[model samples]
Target: MNFGPPLTTRETPAQRAQGELILGFKRLGAVTKIDTLFQQGALKARLPRPQDPTLCEAVTLNISGGVAGGDALDTMVTLAPGAQLALASQAAERIYRTPGPAARIRTRLIVQEGARLDYLPQETILFDRFALDRELDIDLQGDAEFVGVETLLFGRQAMGEIVQSGSLRDRIRLRHDGRLVFQDATRLEGGIAAQLQRRTVADGARAVAGLIIAGPEAAHKLDSLRAVLNAAPGIVAGASAFDNMIFARLLAPDGASLRQCLISALEACRERRKLPRVWQG
Candidate 1:
């Protein structure tokens, strides 16, 4: 067996490449109908199996493959009257290290008259030195309803790795019948993660998750919902109902605890609204 050029432990000469990706969807129907599509790097939308045909629940979307580094993902979802939709990732969204520039994710949602939609995706975990910017824009009709949740973790806490480096920026805007309801932006850098770990700041927290629930019954569930929030363990959570919508917020050290709190709060709200738990697991 002949060996190649003097096996050097360190190789030299390198090449770099860059690319972009986008994923989108739209709904079309008068009463309980949906149309969807997606396009991304090495990812495509597959036809979902029909289940419980009579229910007015929205179509479910799952990201089967992980979003790779150096790949940008953009998604647009629309819902029509009497129709609803839900979107989620099959697993946690991983932001890998990129040799080029920062990765991006942008999502736009439109809800038509008397429709409902839920945009509950999986948690996003950022590795060391991973850079990402995400923006979410939501538009709802006057009588439409929308619920969404986003969970963010700085790094893999199980490895005892602290998010000492990296950058995460997120922006969100919600509009109801052309009326703005919520706007939030977070830019973390320059030891911000360490500052968040402080009790005075985030109370030794490592994860943050929030829920935006808006609809007709959102006005009367604050008291009962707050009671449920007070009972969840290992979480600091609260619920507020006013202005025809209810919002719930949760902060925890990990994703499991935060998800539990969200599930409980969701169930409580569903009960309060006399509606079935539409969250399909």
Candidate 2:
């Protein structure tokens, strides 16, 4: 008599994965080890043998393939006093079109007194209609050094795909000894292609990259870094130094040209430090 529902079946809701990765490095005399590593959901981190005995390297991988709508990723890296570390991604990150909610990514870097960190991940490729919101927050203590780069591509040029409409919001914040030193934010929506073509914007460039270096030597190396950027081929690049930091902006016709310019700039900035081995291939 009470069978009004008639055995109705309820569809299961799709589960959107939320992933996080945390890595910590500490120095014992001249050697560094991955003192702490925690991974959950679809994110994983690996520590490989460093070519330099005093440096530690960590590579992050996204096992879920790529990010989609309703997905979230949070990453944190910490370096102990006097430690040296380099963090890179296994490959280029791909952002797929989101039908509803925008994908979110947050990265935080902490460098202790006298420590050094290199955050050099590969480019992030955005597919047509994709939506993404990303933020990078850096905290540095006394005499700590940081070198980081962020590269973005509108779409896969080699695949004959171009992004016409999409949404992207990116922010970068840096603090030294609990005092904010640098902050940058960018927002794009609707017809991103048309916006990027504006003279005041990318000026028809399909790829853009930013490199930031902060340390005691940043100001001293500004001229050399500017020279390297100026010598880059087929790329529009500029370098400036202020507030104990050296910043460079690059715009290129495609990702390949941008990568070349970035490699040269990184070498100049790091001095004796070499690019991450993953970048060679």
Specify the highest-TM-score model's number: 2
RMSD in order of candidates: 5.1, 2.4
Tell me the spans in candidate 2 whose CA falls farther than 4 Å from its real position.
Answer: 1-13
lDDT of 2: 0.90
lDDT of 2 at 153: 95
Per-structure clash totals for the candidates: 2, 0
For residues 18-68, what per-residue lDDT tens digits would candidate 1 score against the true structure?
Answer: 222232333443334435444544433333443434223423233434443
TM-scores of the candidates in the order shown: 0.78, 0.95
RMSD of 2: 2.4
For model 1, the run of ten residues with the poorest summed lDDT = 15-24
| Weakest 10 consecutive residues of candidate 2 by summed lDDT | 1-10
User: Candidate 2 on 1-281: residue-level lDDT in tens?
Assistant: 46575676998865676999998889998888888889999889988788788888889999989988778999999999999998899999999997788899999999999999989999999999999999999999999999999999999888988899999999999999999999888899999999999989899999999899998778998888888888888889888899889888899999998998888888878776877788879
Candidate 2 TM-score versus the reference: 0.95
Clashing pairs in 2: none
